[model samples]
Target: MDIHGRQLQSAKQHQVFVNFRGDELRFGFVSHLVEALQRHQINVFIDKLERIGEDLTNLFVRIEESTIALVIFSRRYTESRWCLDELVKINQLTDQGLLKVIPIFFKVEPVTVKQLRGAFGDQFRDREWEYRCDKPRTERWRDALASVSCKIGLTFEKKSNESEFVKIIVKEVKKMVQPQENYVVVPFPGIRRRRDTSSHGRQCQEEQVVLSRESAVLVQENSKIANQIAVVSMRYMDIESENSVIRAQLGELSERLQSLNSIIEVVEGVVGKVPEIPEFLMNPWQIMSTSSQPITASADMFYYP
Candidate 1:
């Protein structure tokens, strides 16, 4: 329920968000798809727009803005952390009903991606070890992979014809991007003409106007509620941030306390072995012989400074 960061604003600009690994899909399959979509006048967003030091917030915004996402799952897709992160975000948007996802498995089986098997499994295992300390993130990545791979999508095998596949994918994308045509049902003209129903029609129109007004009021109320939710989410994020800081500080304090305890133990051990006073330190006029008496556990020499 708590939205943060990019969730502060709504995106209503782009049409399609292409989520793919640049190294594997950029030059070949994704390129062709982008060109085909562009040729058809579709507003497409690809990672090619990404630059050095570009804020990743832009990527999320683009994904949110897009009506549909084309997630091209390639063999090396999981190898790139950015790709995985994008996939997670895409899935999040999809779950929220903010975006539709059409996954395209390229040179990788849907089962392999879903189960993290074959080369996908290999890379995933390596990444798991690499991110062993961040298991939730890894798990989210895996979940995203499973979620997307299970969706109905086009698949391109290693030996599959690229051009033919691109054409099919383009056609599919076109179908998604195209607006649905509204069909009006016309009554048959063979029926006899009825008497004028002006009064009834006027009453129906009046009822429709009342309903429209009520709908508008409901919409406004919903908008207000959404705004209130956003404010609460921001507050929650601030609280979470403060909690994290407090936890970190507490951890530091706990470590410092342990260190102080160890230092105290060392000092105690050294002090417990109370040594006899040196004869040289005794007053010259009042020479004192070394004490033959054993020091007791309650000796004053054991007192701390």
Candidate 2:
């Protein structure tokens, strides 16, 4: 995949926009995050360039155009005046429902961002004093932070490993954006042709092509089904052959048992002992059909047939 081309397309396509301070995170955490997102085909616009006063308009346009914004609030995040300005614009887009903001508190507590405490508080104080002349403008930045801090977002703690934290972030981003490649879209030949049709003559020709393509597809599908049936039939034949062998073995064992019984009866007769013959050997069907006493051998019994 052409990552640079896709990133450019994404800038116009407005997939996901990332807002972060370059000084603290550009070479480290934010760079890794952008790379991970891009690997998944999730186009990202990482804010790595310096934001000049003249470029603020274009920057705001980019933020407004995006569908989702990722604002990484790091320790030195509040220190950048331009970063604060971007945050306010992002918040504005979020409030208007035009954009979705996902805040990432990197090694900083959400409350610290909300209340402007900890290192963030100290930086904001310095900026407040630096821009003390413009109290209202500074106040807007503080409000933006507070509002963004209250939002639901991912957090990377100081004790947590960066690589694992990035994976979790990417997973969450995937859930939110749900990249197109993750889904299967089966297009109908006719409908697809209709979409590509430019003129009446072209439409008719395309329709013919679509019909032929659909016919070929249907034939292929049927061939697959027939092959599957053939495989199943072969398996069934093998099972039937195995069953025939088992039955033949059982028949041989039954014949051997009958012969052994006949020899024992002959020995009993020679010894002047009458041996009882089971009714089943004589007539098993009769025993099943009628509820009567089974016929047995007696000393006077004789067969003259």
Candidate 3:
């Protein structure tokens, strides 16, 4: 299959499709959110990891396959045509009732997104007219943004605890997608919400949080590698067991063929003629199914001359 085909197949069907500006949050909040979602066994689709030089249509496929789409509206999110295009597709699917959308106001207000006034809007509006020549596409983007901003969503303000915020978002995600009886994020009693009163204080706290989150990601990846190793070991053991069975069966067939050869030799010496065994009779295991049952060679399997 071609590269596109392989990518589509591997993308699979996820429960959540995350739409975000890659350059901004590829390694920060997005990573934390994805990790938390995965811990709950909620599959997510993040395009930045797999995007190949403006291969944009495949993302639409991911949107259709997903049951829910999380639109993370950061300051510059609307600036990218890709993000705008995705919102359009998401809006289409959501209108059809084929998909659910959860907008995330990441330091960007919903009113600004709906009204096209803030940094997000400025970035989108300031794009070269040459790039926005397609009036229909631009109109679709405007409608999508205006409509999506009206949905109920989570807002990430300045002073919230990053880790706890992730849990809360994940909890909401779980409730929306899974619909369990009780969806909750247990609080960290000891840890206080980061004080973003001053830029210096916020910077120090953010740096500390970033370090801890990176460490957590490393531990998670290592644990996954270890589990994969265990699975490979189990698969190897299964193959070895099958090999042992094959060898034992071959040995048994060898002994039976020797016995038949001796009988044939005796008969030839007495009557100058010997029975001929069929190929399948000589190698009965060739017709044996892969099941544990063995194929026993029998005299009736051959004809006497």
Candidate 4:
């Protein structure tokens, strides 16, 4: 499907996965950007893998198929091995022309990124010490950052606030998409004559027929992918629902167990405080209490007593 003039190349209908290091503000900012994209009818796939697990490799695989990656470059971001690994994979994918990476530098200087200094420096310190030299390591890091800067637009600012960052990012994406409105359709070469030659007209008709068939096929493929995504989403929802039910049941069971324990404790305390009594006769206290109650016994009760 095409939006405006730009082809919506995603196979899944409403999916975009966002991968970010564990920065609350960064995640919120990306979520806002996603909302903006959704407003434009773009499907986003978001990976909340942090909640699920910390296996960076698994996370990388999840990110590999995404159309675009938005990286939030904070001071702490470089410190995370998973984040760095993700960046490396992104760099690889971008080099292979498979995906686009957008870098949003939050409160981190471009110089710091370029130099791999400070937090970045610390992250790579082990490797640097392994090589027994800092200069080569720093140079390679600078080159990598420079390449990333050239390939992916980097926004460096002091503000780490999510809302402000989202606004800036949305504006930038808007500008990028603005020029694509005109590229949607290229007009067929203008025909000079009212009627084409018979042979040329037949060829043009055939070409038009072919184009129509291709368009239909593309639409069908898109529909199929959309259905698949829907199914996957539904499955995820079911799993989540099941998990919630299980959790609720577990909570109830825990409460019941606690209540049982409390009851047992109370029973044990009462039993411990009770005085011993002969099996065949009532205790003095019990007999006195019964006598004070103005007992009305039948002939059978008196005989039994």
Instruction: Output the TM-score of candidate 4.
Output: 0.45
Off by over 4 Å in 1: 1-10, 183-305
What is the lDDT for 126 in model 2? 91
User: In candidate 1, what residue range of length 10 has the lowest lDDT sum?
Assistant: 183-192
State candidate 2's TM-score. Answer: 0.53
Model 1 residue 166 CA deviation in Å: 1.0
Against the true structure, candidate 1 reaches a TM-score of 0.57
Residues 112-171 of candidate 3 have per-residue lDDT tens digits of 666566577678766535466788887677667766776678888767788987888888
Each prediction's TM-score versus the true structure: 0.57, 0.53, 0.53, 0.45
Best by TM-score: 1
lDDT of 4: 0.57
Error of 3 at 10 (Å): 17
> What is the per-residue lDDT of model 2 for residues 149-193, given as tens digits with 9 covering 90 to 100?
766798889999999999998888887777544332224443422
Worst 10-residue stretch by lDDT in candidate 3? Answer: 180-189
lDDT of 1 by residue, 1-305 (tens): 23542453354577888988888778877888889888988899997787879987678777777888999888888788888888889877666546678999888887777656678878977887899999899877866776667667989988989989988987888887776443211232443233334998556556655765676567546644543554355346548879999999999999999999898788779887546687666666443345667646666677887
Q: List the residue pairs that clash in candidate 4.
A: 5-184, 15-43, 15-44, 15-45, 16-44, 16-45, 17-45
lDDT of 4 by residue, 172-195 (tens): 655543544322221245422233
Per-residue error at 95 for model 3, in Å? 0.3
State how far residue 213 of model 1 sits from its true place (Å).
23
